[model samples]
Target: MRNDRTIKWLILLIPTLTIGLWEYIRHAFLLPYLSMELGNLLAPFIVLAVTLTLVRSLFARLEQSQQALQREKGTNAALEERERLARELHDGISQSLFLLAVKLDVLDEMKIDGPVKELATGLRETVRVMHEDVRQAIANLRLPPSPAAAAWVVPLRELLGETAEMSEAQADFSWSIPDVSLSDKEKVELHACLREALINVRKHANATKVLVVGEADGFGGFRCAVEDDGKGFSGDPLQSPGRFGLRMVRDRATAMGWNFLAERRGDWTIVELRKQGGAAS
Candidate 1:
């Protein structure tokens, strides 16, 4: 504020001072050599030019600073929204999903039969998959806004490590890219997709070892691969049991113009997410 007042004063004073000095010089010194008529006509124009030179630079700098401050405020607002969203998801959807899963578990164990039993079983699996989806959603909401690739990838790595440990699976994590050039939206989707993949490996893949890889896709994009040496299943990604997470990941990838593929390579089941034409926003 003080700086603003000073700038305002400077802006007002520059023209006044320029005109005053010009008048004084014309009367005191240049009047005798130059004609009075010429001085009168040129004084205001000279003052205007001088004041413009002085004010232009200041205005330019002020404009730049204002733009920078606006950008910072925008970033802060986005982060705050993320934090609020995370809290709401955890407190509302996550808890609700947990409760639903518990109810489904009870239903699964009940002495029911016929179509109802099969429906209950299917619902149980669906709730389990949805529970994992809610977890990944919560994680994504809680993730910090990362400007650098390293910062963004660290959370994903930690998530995989934690999931692997919980599943008692040995994880070999490798990241060849120091940073990724992806938009914030892309980063969140990528992280969520990777987390879901790892969760699938943890819960369903009865695998003893998992190899997680993150690297450039060699086409101006990035790729995340989660390969598990588990008992591979055969079926369509969308129609298989315990495969809802894969479907969600695939849908997000498709919506974002990325690529998602799940296949058995040799003895390992590999899930790969690729983002082509990666660029930061």
Candidate 2:
């Protein structure tokens, strides 16, 4: 920022100072041999030379700084994204591994009269779930970083498309979002939330068509929704057995400092995520 300010000052002051000095010289000294008319005629050329020599150089330097800043920002964002993905992988595997160990310990400590078959079945299920989690994490790791060169919503479009195919639902998606509305971290969280919402729609909502829409809120904020025309299921996360996915999404929203809404609006089941203006993005 300091460099930026200095460059701007140079851009403005170089021309103004040059013209002022030239005028003073033209009147006070050049007026004798360099006539008033000749000095007047040469003023434009002097200014042009100063602009080309000093101001133009400053402008190029300023542009280079801007490009450097952009590159730095992209690098930082990429690092942050990698860190977040690593955390996701670690957390998922650690929790499942810990649970698996606990189950194993219980089985090992069981008595002859214990429910050994039941415990075995539970252990098998846990292992299956852990396997799936590992597979998913590996797949996520293989995905390239968010394409900065393309629209950020490109991945979301593919996700929704897959949801549509898997659920046999016609999905309609649209967005009108300005750039910088979501930071990379916020985008990851939003993607997870939307993925969870779509999973709920596919597994629970018996809908024929789904609408996913995102838009700038006209206040430097953004909102997106996944709405399905199906039998919307609703319950308190604490009391609902099938609402675990929504619970996970809601937890993620809270973590991201965003708003989460899941409700039945008339005939549509709506799952919406929103973040207000002045967010880190």
Candidate 3:
């Protein structure tokens, strides 16, 4: 922006200054040695020389510098977005495959006749669900970035609905956040964290129902979560086989100075993201 302004100002000022200085010098002191007709011809050539050697070159260098800066910015943005997608893949798709593999290995080890057919059918369903997830992720990643997008609740609601549809689970989202509660980037980041949580629920939770809730208070603090009535493990979910996605969600929240937790609350497995402090709601 600064460079653009400088270029504009120079484009207007340089020509006028050059012409004025040349005319003044020619008329003021050269009148004795030079005739009016000769001075007139030399005046144009002098201005042309200054323009070609100085103004043109200066503008060319400035434009080249500007172009370089733009290219650098574009490269940085692309790299950042690529990293974001890589994280998503590691957390979502990779973790899903890991769980699928674990389940299959367990099923293979079991020689029971009755449950073998059931386990095989379940594994097939899991594969089909994963295929749907990958397709949905590709469609989402292809969308252009939009900072001035709709309110946070819109996409989150749609995502929860999709998760429910794919998993054949009951899903509901309750949002109490006003439009002013979160900035654009905050909304985007929180949405992504919640997405990973939902993916975990869909792939590994074996949930029959899902509930997502988001709310903000007057103190600029907010809370959000993806909760499911899924099977509970004996230890911390962070130490479980599907920990990769949860850890990614935790890292994202921590980087934003927010709190994240993946744990079982009674019979409910809740993955929560929160920020406890800021300006008055």
Taken over the whole model, the C-alpha lDDT of each candidate is: 0.79, 0.77, 0.78
Estimate the TM-score of every prediction. 0.72, 0.56, 0.56
lDDT, candidate 1, 1-281, per-residue tens: 46766777787788888888898988899977989789989987897788679877777766777788798999889889988888888889879878887887888788889999988887777677667667776677677666664687777677777767876878788988535455568767877788788878877888888888988766578778889999977866667975788999899888887778999878999898876654432
- Better by TM-score, candidate 3 or 1: 1
Instruction: Give a tens-digit lDDT track for model 2, residues 73-170.
Output: 98788777866776777777757776786777777666644577676767766566456545555566556565574355676677677768867889
lDDT of 2 at 247: 84
Model 3: how far residue 49 lies from native, Å: 36
Instruction: Give the Cα error of residue 210 in candidate 2, in Å.
Output: 2.3
Worst 10 residues of 1 by lDDT: 177-186
**Residue runs of model 3 more than 4 Å from their true location after superposition:** 1-127, 146-153, 179-185, 279-281
Best by TM-score: 1
| Whole-model alpha-carbon lDDT for candidate 2 | 0.77
| Ranked candidates, highest TM-score first | 1, 2, 3
lDDT of 2 at 207: 82
**Considering every candidate listed, which one attains the maximal lDDT?**
1
Clashes of each: 0, 0, 3
